[model samples]
Target: MSALTGAAAVAGCGGDDAGGTSSNSPGATSGGAERDCSLKHPVCTAVTSDCVAVHDNQGATTLGLRMAQLTITKPDVLASGYVAGLVTQGLTMNLPQCNLNGTGTFSWLLEFDTTTGKLRTGGAMPTVDPREGYCFANMTAGEFEIAPTEIDAPLTDGAWSGEAETLNVPIFLETSPEPIILPLHQVRLTDAKVSADNNCIGRYNVEGLEWDNACLPGQDGDPPAFINGGKLAAFITLEEVDRVIVDAVKQSLCVVLSGDIVKYGTGADTNTCKRDENDQIVLKGDWCSATNSPATDDCADAYALGGEYAASAVKINGLCPQ
Candidate 1:
């Protein structure tokens, strides 16, 4: 799998600038003439043309990274939510292919005893591809509780509980030219409470989450990354495990001295996560580019077009079983 490789500073949060003359800015002057390069520009044939490729690629990479992290770090949480309805009848989870060559197919035949909240594999568990870095084999046996009868508990209405142990899981991030791979060592999740309402939409929220040695790159030397606070929300269905929709917002501080990356703050500045009315994650932003020409310099209005220019970059909707 292609992972983002570079310093975090250069791979800053994705966003569009209001107005700038930087060549990297989408709406910069093409020539000496003032030209309106916004989507409404009469001369500009396509306003979103520049934003399409980068936007879509970034969105896909982000979604894939999030899904892979969730899957690798906490399979029990997923099993409980995706297969909650089949507790008594039993089910085999056929994971969809996540790679380009259609090879990361995984299967788990699980039988759940709803009466005792015990879960066990019915047959030999399929070996997860090591290249994918998801430790599925460690989830062979576990216990789960769907619709726990606890009162005054958050997500009590449709909550699932489970636990697992993960070692050296890899998480990917997008940089300017390449992807960066970070190794999370000795990670463990216990008392994981996942919400199964609306088909496991609340599976992103976890309880008792801990990790060690997240080796992030730095100038002086590699430093351990820290998470001050964050919220990750996802919507997933059992039929499609590969195309999980996710919205993640994190508040953290890191010293990246290698590249020119954006520093994320703690408030709305970190609200890069966006979702639609249906609670499905959506890429929201405009890609406005302007010519240097004086006639088309007013590309500021391009931001107001108000539509997802990176719709083609989304893959979660079509992540059906293959």
Candidate 2:
């Protein structure tokens, strides 16, 4: 969640000239006493989802700021096609309707803190206070702010189309009136199965893909590491069709989706683990203490979570492939 710095503190639990922590502030917890993880709120155990949900929905709002949404689409995307991951690098912001001005870019880099992919803005815009109906009330003609999120990735690409919307606007009291809403929406390349030729090509490299504990727990040496004690599985396919073979290509590995490792082994001596694609090793999925012993089981479900892999590497096993 973004923070309101300097002097943009008013409606909700915003602070003043003195920088105050949200928890320490008077009204920070005023929103219905901060709902707990009850049957009403329900806990989401998925790791990958936690960050996206927070930043995607309430991020700008938490900081008392708003975000712009970007969408991309392709004109002639075939019915049987898919892009595992697409990155958006450059972006610009403009709000002609609001009679306001500012700048910034949004991208996929924020999805994973460690990724190098990113989008940047050229300048700043005044913060959008939904409380004030996204009003640009505080700033003079020149002052501005920047708001961004990790969910703005281009979901589709292939003769594509795109749009950007700024959530930075104003809001008014119920008695005051209505405000402008910047709804970001897009439909990128749709999902479609590969053709027979493509499917045949996708099948040639099945042996190259395998699950291992590279991204699992106890491997990074740092407990706080993102993949520490985590589980992962990948399915990789290499195919040759139409005289074109997508080599060194990677798609998705299912186990990594849940953001948690699928368990394997007996009641107590069970060994939980995940396969890390980048490092090509099995990582411990179960968390261990300095004193506790490691899991007794040597193998985790290799095909767990429908995990798939599509990568290009020189080594096919402990030794490189000829």
Candidate 1 residue-wise lDDT, 77-182, digit = tens: 2222221111101111111111011112222212223334442221111223322222222221112111111112122332333322212111111111111111
For each candidate in turn, the TM-score is 0.19, 0.14
Off by over 4 Å in 1: 1-113, 119-156, 160-187, 190-322
For candidate 2, lDDT tens digit of each residue in 242-306? 11111112111122221222331111222222335563234332312222223335432122111
Candidate 2 error regions (>4 Å) = 1-18, 22-125, 128-130, 135-322
Best by TM-score: 1
Model 1 poorest 10 in a row by lDDT? 305-314
Give the distance in Å from residue 68's predicted Cα in candidate 2 to where it truly belongs. Answer: 6.8
lDDT of 2: 0.18
